[model samples]
Target: MNVMEIRNTLGASVLCAVMFIGITALPATLAADDDAPARETATAEPPDPRLVSRGKRLYVFCRACHATEEVKGSKIGPNLAGILNRPAASLEDSLYSDALRQQDFVWDEEKLDTWLLRPATLVPGTSMAFVGLPQEANRTAIIAYLKTL
Candidate 1:
């Protein structure tokens, strides 16, 4: 092929390569920018019906392991009835990890919030297999629903 023809072909190939790269990266760049407004922002909304209902919906996963029963014990996890204000791992029948059972604190809102964010982090060696609710809104919803139990 002639040098002029080769140069024109090479220029076209480079242009296509650059355009392809830009097109591929555009969506990811825009996605990051779209989330910028919400980054590090707290929810202005208080615990409302939407949050409670959302939490109730989220609680379906917990139902497999726990029950709302006060006296009847759960096989997978402890009964969560009246969990708020109750001491951690207070249920005598269930097997609680030493880290959790030794904690000398009640299941208050603040504590529950932290725990639900990451159960293993809150109590290392705890038996809970849940990774955690990373989303603040989801955690808030779950905690609100827990209050109803």
Candidate 2:
């Protein structure tokens, strides 16, 4: 082969080698991207049954002060029997805090969770002297139990 032809062949081989390396390396690059820790999957899991049971057990602590029975004017705190769906300050004959009575809010899971986390923060100038449940799991359990009420 001529000198020019030989040189051209060598250049072509070098180019081919570089391309092969690049192509082979692409999969590993892609795999690294794929293998990166997966993003936390957003899920709405049903409330744990054990949590609900535990909440029910813990609720006995509250029962002395707050009656779960629907019969109104029967406890230190308003009867919480049907509190889940009720309006925030709609309890009749129950002296709710001025702050709570002024605010228009419905008691729901989300609101309950926040309230349970910090009652004073959730409703400023509230009369609920009991400090809120701090642990998320316990709060969730208590909320589940409250819903059953």
**TM-score for all predictions?**
0.65, 0.64
lDDT of 2 at 120: 90
* Prediction 2 TM-score vs. true: 0.64
* Residue 25 in model 1: lDDT: 100
**What does candidate 1 score on TM?**
0.65
Q: Write the per-residue lDDT of candidate 2 for residues 1-149, one digit (tens) a residue.
A: 99999999999999999999999999999997876655323443456788789999988767877888675454767788877878998977787878999989889989988987888998989887778788898888888888777
Clashing pairs in 2: none
C-alpha lDDT values of all predictions:
0.87, 0.82
Clashing pairs in 1: none
The sequence of per-residue lDDT tens digits that candidate 1 reaches over residues 1-149 is 99999999999999999999999999999999989779737544345778789999999878889988776676688999889799999888888888888899999999989888989887888999987888988888888888877
Candidate 1, overall lDDT? 0.87
